[model samples]
Target: MEPAQLTAAVVSIVNTLRIILEYMQNRPKRRQHEDDFDEDVDTDVPESTGCGNWEIVVAVGLVDTVERQFWARQTSTDWWDRIVLQVWDDAQWLQNFRMLRPLSWNTVSYFPLPKMRADLTVEKRVAIALWKLATPDCYRSVRNQFGVGKSTVGAAVIQVASAIIGVLLLRVVTLGNVQVIVDGFAAMGFLNCGGVIDGTHIPILAPDHLPNQYVNHKGYFSMVLQALVDHKGRFTNINVGWLGKVHDTCIFRNSGPFEQLQEGTYFPDQKITIVDVDMPIVILGDPAYPWLLWLMKPYTGSLDSSKEQFNYRLSKCRMVVECAFGCLKAHWRCLLTRSDLSTTNIPIVISACCVLRNICESKGKMFMAGWEVEANRWHLILSTQTPG
Candidate 1:
């Protein structure tokens, strides 16, 4: 083959460059016209007037027109609009895919293109919808604030939440260290290690079920939530799916995390025990959990100060899980309320929140560590618990 053919096989670089040059030369140039056709368009049209191909072309043109009109009007926003616009322009959010070009509102195909100058991106639309759902504001209030269709708010929120959880948040953080802190105390000895591993009654709208499988102590509808955090108080693993009626021990047995742990390949430094391979793992909880291996309990029911101190210390260490859960709830208030979430979707939502939390915490670890040193010194003195 010729050198040209070999070069062609490698890349169409030369050909592409030539084509680009030709395109630049011949491409349509905008020539300002005194008037271009009718400035306005006809609204009424028969739906069946065009064939599929013609309809597609016309649809694309309509979308382009909407985008163009939306952006063109933004240049002349009044003082009030300008304030809102300027604030939106200055706001920052996490976006790693920064290579994409800035979207021209005039050219983008938003479902309902802004009739007025202003328009929102899909992300902002979703965020606002979620905020409304989390807040006490009515749909009309939200519609006025966001300048969107009142009827579309609920649908938009559900769609955005579904997409975020289903497509974005199902990924689990890779487990490492597999740190285990096991301590057994007197009287009613209990496991205060992995987590309380108990099912909290989270009532939801009852769904059509096969039997009484999902019914729990509260009698409404609920799911089991088993969380596992490390010594540093970060979640290593969390299982949430079982019905509220399911025993914590049963949830643990079926959690599959223990299976991985028994295989000696779950997390880094996780080892399998030879004897009692199927034994329930040690996790932090009150005396209610009987199956835990390394259990810790306070002294007798008597009001001894030393016993109170031990319980207080245990509570401090256990408080890590509560803090992580609280932060997750605070950031994504959607979780705090009863969700219309199905069993299939709940785990994804939970996982995605964890991922976002991990991403933020990991990014801010260095900045956090600086203030944390001073805080840690005071914590050591004040805390009944020994430093891990």
Candidate 2:
């Protein structure tokens, strides 16, 4: 063959191979996983990078900008769906119970990856946990149905409960012919009674030469929890931080109450005047309680008609606290067992649980007590006493 003809044939073959390679490279793969563009390449564009020589810089810039815009839109859509639209903007529930305070979205802003959107809201999460607490269920089951971790559910319970306790439950306003009922329970039969007084034998993996203080009067390793409940059955005050060995009266006296009495102060709001006098206020307790005028127990006088009647009403009202405690323990069976937790953390956990219980109670229908109006009456009475 002539040299010129041989060169021309080689050139043609090379061109054909190049065209086939470009077609194969640009051809669409499976369209399922990622977006695929058409195989066609504009003839005006240069071959090497499929970009025209003059358009390279602009193309790079445009690609970067488009990529950034795509990511930004995705992020905004995710936030709108999960936090704003799904959780906060639930119209029906929000209409009834609007958030008392603004949610700190900033706290979760650090979560870079978007959380999967779900049908559940924080309120729904809380309600589910409350339901579980009312009806015991395995943490695994709760987690599975809620599409949340057990730890997350527990945290939600604590967080919701804290909000209710801190914001929703009103403080004790006025004491109206106030009567108190107090009783003590024993874990292994030790006298405890300020409100729900009990000595729980928290069995620790026996420590080496543990302090005698850890051993209680029952000759067992235990701790004591003594608390005081208000007339409404709400735990108005708690007195913890006692070693298991401490007696109920001892724990109570050691608590802030004894000091307050010494200072001639009574009632939770120490500064508030009671019945026109800056005098100390009374607290109701059973005979087991120390002798204090402000602290009244059932009149031991023969269980006559008036006494029985008064006692009955007092017990009815006082039992609120007992019922509250019972409800708390029944739900968190972890509390019923000997907790291996340390002394300080125990009180904190208990307080957290109580606050959570109040949150649960707030969800259900709650009618104001008769004392609410009685309190208003006292406000008028007290206001009249003030010199205008």
Candidate 3:
């Protein structure tokens, strides 16, 4: 045959084989006999395709080999087995997931997750959620670390966060121990102080609906978290999910805590006499908030020495809330950067993080000093970057 004719014949034969293979792979299966139709019968042929018995066997073998190879490559070092399973020491456990191992296990034990797979145990689900929250990793990054699909990683994060909020939020963040908190503040030179109130912005992706409404003064899409922290840097109450454009006073006025304080129901009836004036137990706030009978703010504009001294004392007490915000963001880094979760869900996740922070604080799980340094570094970078 001529060279051109030979090449043409080979191409035609290759095309024909490609079409046949595709058809075989996609075509409907046919039963060879009545027994083949029986659901209980074992068949050599593939049930989903029209491939012959021998072809099906070969394909199954090949698939098994490829799957084994893929998993082997993914788990050669087996990060979970080598690092997580081996770390029984509490210090190392805290370093890895920002919570003591026992605390983590105990937290998840209260609300066990449904067994989705053989590998996704309740403990693993909690670990996955904590890892995602404690670091600024994307879903794909978390999947790679845990050897799960990206969708699984995302689902695990939301499920565990929801569980935390539902199970622990009320227990951990509340004013039930108001007297103890007031005493703690009194020890810090702010007599009759119950807590400190402040607001912070949590960055988030722009939503499709009214994206401009989420923009803050810094020109980034965000949500506001107005929290009241006790002297121990634990959240006693939080009002979250407000649009970033909302003012602090607006959020405070509309919060449940505001109504409680207004009715004289938030704090106890304890009071102290200062310069012949009876001062009731009150919460300290910044100048952005209204100065109610129960909410004290610093004097604005020109200040005399007495006013300045009062402001300094109030600020000193208010530092707890500022440190609480810093620690919350530092511990759960998802708050610092824009979260991949939807705008509606980010608030719940943030609330869950606050609850977890309170758990850690109340339990004496000290915040890792390194996290603050790293968080500050990232904050500087994010601040200097041009807003998008």
Best by lDDT: 3
lDDT of 2 by residue, 1-388 (tens): 8999999999987876675556556655523312332111112322344434433433334334232111111112243346444675434222222222122121111222223237545545454444343333455555554555555555555554444445433432112222232222212121122232222333222223454776655454545555555444455555545665676677777776567655654434333354585523445455556655444456666788977865665454445555555555543443444444445444554554555444445454322234234333433443333111
Q: Please identify which of the two predictions, 2 or 3, would achieve the higher TM-score against the true structure.
A: 3
lDDT of 1 by residue, 48-85 (tens): 32233333444434334232221111122242244443
lDDT tens per residue, model 3, 1-388: 9999999999987876675587576755644553533221223433443445545444434344232111112322277767787845878778768888888888765685655767677777788899899889988778788876666777788888888888888888887677888889888878999999999999887778788888888888889999998888889899989998999999999999888889887888888899998988999999898888889999989999999988889999998998999999998898988878988789889999999998888788469878888888877876765444
Model 3 misplacement above 4 A: 1-77
For all predicted structures, in order, the TM-scores are 0.48, 0.41, 0.80
Question: Which segments of model 1 are wrong by more than 4 Å?
Answer: 1-85, 88-120, 129-145, 149-172, 177-201, 208-215, 267-283, 286-314, 341-347, 363-388
Would you list the clashing residue pairs of candidate 3?
none
Q: How well does candidate 3 match the true structure in TM-score terms? A: 0.80
Ranking by TM-score: 3, 1, 2
Candidate 1 lDDT for residue 286: 47
| Per-candidate total of colliding backbone pairs | 9, 7, 0
Of 1 and 3, the candidate ahead on TM-score is 3
Q: What's the ranking of the predictions by lDDT, best on top?
A: 3, 1, 2
Q: lDDT per prediction?
A: 0.46, 0.44, 0.81
Q: Which ten residues in a row have the lowest lDDT in candidate 1?
A: 92-101
